[model samples]
Target: MNKLEIHSPNSPILLTASLHVDEARKAIASLVSDLLTESQSRNEAGSVELVTLDQAINRILAEDLLSPIDVPAADNSAMDGFAFNGDCLSSKDDIVTLKVVGTAYAGKPYEGSIGKTECIKIMTGALMPNNCDTVIPQEFTESSDSSSVTFKQNQVKRGENQRLRGEDLQSGKAAISAGRLLRPSDLGLAASLGIATLKVHRKLKVAILSSGDELRPLGQALDAGGIYDSNRHSLTGLLNRLNLEIIDCGIVRDDPASLKSAFLEAASLADVLISSGGVSVGEADFTKQIMQELGDVGFWKIAMRPGRPMAFGVLKPADPKNPDRKSLFFGLPGNPVAVMVTFYQFVRSALLQLNGANQTEPPLIQAIAQTPIRKKPGRTEFQRAILERGPDGRPTVRLTGSQGAGILRSMSEANCFVILHHDQGNIAAGDWVDVALFDGLL
Candidate 1:
């Protein structure tokens, strides 16, 4: 058999690929580009809902929100003081005592206009009466009587302590662009612009699944050869944080027939399908077989140590049940640590592309290793480590323990992953290492 070939039938190797790490990634990215291109054609059928500003939190902007009117609406006072003609204040020491023509409060305009040597008492957010050019803060003026005040100093400049109309947003200008995800501050900005309703992109629908005969549900009796399904729960929580619509497909057997049914159902309803386990080289690894039957399995096997057999593909119906509808899928490995590493490296990128995210890669930083480490030279490695600030304030990191695929406790104890490049064989203490911060689980 060739290096890429995986012997079928009763062969020991379940699935193998000829491509190396970089080649595999490029191939997978190519497939993902196709899927993303096709996804663009799948028009969102969900109808829009006119929700109030309070209810529109975290939704995508469906259309560009333009300002119908300028923010501040008109020239207004920024503080509680007096509005006056700025030219009347001649010098720094010049103090002009003027009668208060009218009092103004926020949302209530002062009827009378200010003339030369005249002023109007105004409150915060209150509009300046016509012909007033500047506002003197109340702290700089002394109240001589209820209807008059004396300026203590005359150093204020024109438009000082005043909010000019359209300073923030001009009429017909775009206040918020289309496809922006709404946040608290965004909501407040929209509210300030008098926008009660906003059009936003529909929430992405994702289907999550976990497969293994040894898996058991929560609060269920664990018989022999059974383990609780932690991958499904972990993925569900992660997707929840992204604010996507999650369709839990629950647990399924490691059989080809069962996987086929689950894939069909997930493909029909969900925008993306994520499955854990049954993609390795085992005889019972039905996910690999089922993937070939259902659609095109683009790439499998990344030359990353912990996550080697990562799979990416688009599901197409073999039968006539919506043959044109292609559903994106990511087949993560069975080991918990492998699941996480592959998800972050591969699945996350795919999801971002599906969601129209602009940036696909996470941030990276460089740090020094605390101890010497040894490894084989074929694949890259992600060693779990705890990063710390040294006495000199420099960042340093130390690996927890054994860097095994099954050692999930090591990942839990470490705060970051010290990345070892593919060609690297070993490292000495105090050597520089590339560290990827564990921003969150996966």
Candidate 2:
């Protein structure tokens, strides 16, 4: 039963005798890296456009951003205090008093030279006066009048509480490197360096579709044995989070002609074509046949629960006019929960790479399992679980009510995926397990 058998006369045997089911069950990390490499090979040098810093959020940097001027252009005060020469302090055990020469506010400077036994009332961000090298907070000293102040010995140190020019960033230094996706902090840093516009990579275009005769689009009345198409909506929402240009191809019926037309159109329109359903071993599944005729694709039963059946390859144009057109294709399982799990585990990172993002793998944290989990040793299991803080502030997890692949509520209710690794057996209560958090992307 490991390899799908085709017994129907009308269904062509797509699985070759040389196909190895065991070899097709790749580890998730290795498979993702291979997909990213393949995608990078197809992606040419990406084009770039100039955009203001306000519009650069989530965009990939096209080149190194060098600072044209120093951050904090001049030496300023780091606190609202008295600015004075450190040499004027007597000793750590005694108190010293000095005349308040003047007051320096932000955007204003005390132009006169600072003499011995003289200090200035300097506010935060005010320019440090000439010959002044230390700052003592106003609260740390006693001010008898507007012109005189007292400071306790050793209340402040030399060059302490002073902001030096170019301390954050120096002119001509790279502020941000290429390939970085701009965030809010990155935009603020660019603004500090006087960068008004930046060059960034264009957003990736993705085309998504679903296949099956038993599936109907939302707003359409369902016939007998038909289910409303929910995969497209879920896929579209996920793609939108990545900031991709989505080309939704809608639902394609389960027939050879309709599937072929959709595949060809999607290949021509998008850089990547994603399809859910019609990938498993079923007599009515015409998607496998049409996909085989169109391009190089491999059907696999990965050693993972919740999402096992998958298809990966490239689709090329059959028309002579668009002979050079090609698009990466990913065929996901039909079940509602399986579609989401497979996309998050495998396709998310690949799409990020294709979109010119220097993507990092999401972090996995260890948590104590509050209940026992049923699992075998040969397959990895991604059970949806609710992570909570125990009385001692340690992370604990409990499985969602149902673990079936068709139960979409399991994914909706859970905050994290409790990853049971391959070669791991049934879990006992209180056993530590690795979990990947949703982090609001759900």
Candidate 3:
């Protein structure tokens, strides 16, 4: 078995990538490199701000957080046990007995000294009394009275069942590194270290707009050929998962004037603009034309399934007051499934880079193929599938109904994408495949 590091922007995921890059690299890798280079050249300082811990969830840390004091400032009992000197365990007999001097509760330490052959009943998290270096769980004591307790000598070792001071985190040491997206546990850890505020990257403002004359908004009547615009809603949900600030420019008509207006408005207000539809070679696709007129952009047919026609580049604002505020543009496919696939492939990492996050892609898992799948060489395919653990505990996957790009229902029913790499052929029932689950990434 070998490990392969697949990178998108600054995020690198280690997976078993045996084949995809031999031919597919030229298109996807080239585009990724260009976007990453541009993202790195941007002024990172412009995206940093100091925020309180209450408002720092999902935000990227701009600097390492050092602990102000040691965690568990003093040694404490790890469980409800009897605390005593380790020397008590050195008895030459099968059992050691000690008199109960007093009790120690959490927060209130035992002030009296623990003498020889004397122990204190300590609760969990209670500070270890002086001269005590070991503890035997209360359950281990079989012979016990009101004043004394007896336990086997070999039941516990020296310094057992005790939490050492500064063992978890030392004072003046880095508790959390920069570029980490703060989670609930991280906020708790910061509170433990007395950190009231943290320096974090400001949330990236992402504008979403869907194009096409046949598209209509929700809760509205539609014509014979018109369909509800789901692409914008899907893009909005995907962006919300990253905790970015959303600027909804709504749906734009397919005409050149309407498309150009929407493009200009999005670029001026957002750090990134994600639009679905109108990147194809259709006559109504004035999106590409307007994007090129506004800034430098590229329209490429990616060698991938579901999402092939992709547009990526920078959209420079026409506003003279903020001419330097340019937005990275991603024009995704019109199909709902294609929009999601393309977003995960490209737009996700680009947004993470602009938001100052160090990692972008989610970890890839491997599962056994439960159903036979037909494939052609030359293009990578992301098939929606249901992933489950077999009776033997190994993961297995099967396709979720029809694998059509327009069928968004399959994407909703599936838990993961069974990624068949480029140059790969048919997959038998027992073949191993790479999986990207939607648990955290989606």
Off by over 4 Å in 1: 1-33, 39-44, 47-55, 89-103, 136-155, 281-286, 303-306, 318-321, 356-442
The C-alpha TM-scores of every prediction are 0.74, 0.85, 0.87
List RMSD in Å for every model shown.
Answer: 6.0, 5.5, 5.8
Candidate 2 lDDT tens digits, 103-185:
99999799887787899989999999879989998788855468888877767778899999999888998899887878889
Strongest candidate by lDDT: 3
lDDT of 1 by residue, 1-442 (tens): 1111222112222345433556555545666666656655775356244667887775666677898989878889998888888777765556778887788999998997677877888899998876887888888776555778886554467779999999888999999886565678889998887889887656678898998899999999999889888888778866765667899999989777888999889988887888888777663245656666777564366668788776666677554755667777787888887887777666766665556544556677888888898866778888889999978888999999987887778878989988887888898988888988886435
lDDT of 3 by residue, 1-442 (tens): 0111233223212111222333223334444455556656774456579989999988889899999898879999999979999987777988899999999999998999888799999999999987999999999997877699999888899999999999999999899988897888999999988899999988989999998889999998988999999988888888888888999999898888998888988988888888888877563245655765887665556668988776666787778875556677788889999999988877776677656677766788899999899999888899999999998999999999898999999999999999998878999999999999987667
The 10-residue segment of model 2 with minimum total lDDT is: 1-10
lDDT measured at residue 320 in model 2 versus the true structure, 0 to 100: 83
lDDT, candidate 1, equals 0.75
In model 2, the runs with Cα more than 4 Å from the true position are 1-46, 89-93, 138-145, 283-286, 319-322, 428-431
* lDDT, residue 6, candidate 3: 30
- Indicate whether candidate 1 or candidate 3 has the larger lDDT: 3
Worst 10 residues of 3 by lDDT: 1-10
Q: Residue 87 in candidate 3 has what lDDT? A: 87
